[model samples]
Target: MTHRVSELTVAESAWCKSSYSSGEGGECVEVATCAAAVLVRDSKRPTEARLCFAPEAWAGFLQMTTGH
Candidate 1:
């Protein structure tokens, strides 16, 4: 199965760095949520490519990672 994710500009999305990231960056990630999908990108490389996750999948991943 194939899923489609809309490519969005940084300004277009309300991007926020993960709270888990520290000032001294080491493997940091940023995320933004939209109507269609959740956007994720490397905090260190703001201009790089982004990975999109479907809303349901994103929520499931979060729940699993956080052990909720």
Candidate 2:
């Protein structure tokens, strides 16, 4: 259920950069969580389309990425 950021009312303060993101600006990613979904966007282009994921699906993605 991915969607563009323009479709949601996410606050500016809700966005956080990925812990692994380097301050140098390469591969920067940001995530914002709400009651219904987790939002993912490119930190460098926040006005662009964003990806939305169900909470459960987001958990699975984290688990797979962490290999745990």
Candidate 3:
């Protein structure tokens, strides 16, 4: 299941930028882990909507992306 970040109480410090990010502001994203889900938001617009994914689903996504 997925939820919006607005529905959860995630701390600002919890967000971490992707290592692949150039840090020069080029389509970067941030991720945060919570008890119920893993959250994703645009690095440039964090206050906007954020996508939350179940832990299992997030693991699956990583596995698929990494092909490992």
Candidate 4:
């Protein structure tokens, strides 16, 4: 399925960044949780880039990243 992140209302979504996100916000990324999906976006460019993934996929990514 084709995922068009820009189609979604990112501003309305509550995006949260990883604790590991750097203070510079240059390489930092933010995440937003939704009922059907999770959104990953760049903190530096909130409206520029975004990636929307299924909840399960996002959870898997988070688990792999957090290593819990």
Candidate 5:
């Protein structure tokens, strides 16, 4: 049941850029964690739609991406 961060929720979110992001900042993503979901959005266009993931799905994605 993942969904984009609504205007109301966005007001309460604390987004953080990826640590691996370059200082030049060509393109990167930002993430915010909520009580039951993980929110991801492009740093360049934050006002655009975001991609949300359930906690379990997010953990699985990290595992696959990190090859851990």
Candidate 6:
């Protein structure tokens, strides 16, 4: 079931903007929850691209990206 992040219920899914992204307009990234998976999308071209990952993968990605 491919679900768009925008279509997700914000109340249930905690949406967050990447700390890496600042006031810069060119770079924009957002993430939200979907019970079983994590949803990611670009705020710049929201409709252009999006990706999903499992809980473990998302955690790994965060660790890698954040250098933690």
Who wins the lDDT comparison?
3
* Count of backbone clashes, every candidate in sequence: 0, 0, 0, 0, 0, 0
Model 4, poorest ten-residue lDDT window? 4-13
Clashing pairs in 3: none
Clashes of 5: 0
Where is model 6 more than 4 Å wrong at Cα? 1-13
lDDT of 2 by residue, 1-68 (tens): 66555566779999999999879878988999987789999998998889888889999999999998
lDDT of 1 at 38: 81
Q: Residue by residue across 1-68, what tens digits does model 4's lDDT show? A: 55566656655548888688667745887888766668887787877767889888877987998897
lDDT of 3 by residue, 1-68 (tens): 55666788778999999999997889989999989999999999989888888999999999999998
User: What TM-score, over all chains together, does every model reach?
Assistant: 0.79, 0.84, 0.89, 0.73, 0.80, 0.65
Instruction: List ranges where model 5 is wrong by over 4 Å.
Output: 1-4, 7-13
lDDT, candidate 3, equals 0.89
How many clashing residue pairs, candidate 6?
0
Q: What is the per-residue lDDT of model 6 for residues 1-68, given as tens digits with 9 covering 90 to 100?
A: 55554565544246677777767576878887768678787877666656877778999987998899
Candidate 1, superposed: residue stretches over 4 Å from native: 1-6, 9-13
Number of clashes in model 2? Answer: 0
Q: After superposition, how far is residue 67 of candidate 2 from its true place, in Å?
A: 2.4
Tens digits of per-residue lDDT, candidate 5, 22-52, equal: 9696799988888878888898898888888
lDDT of each: 0.78, 0.86, 0.89, 0.75, 0.80, 0.72
lDDT, residue 34, candidate 6: 69
lDDT of 6 at 1: 56
**Model 5's TM-score against the true structure:** 0.80
lDDT of 2: 0.86
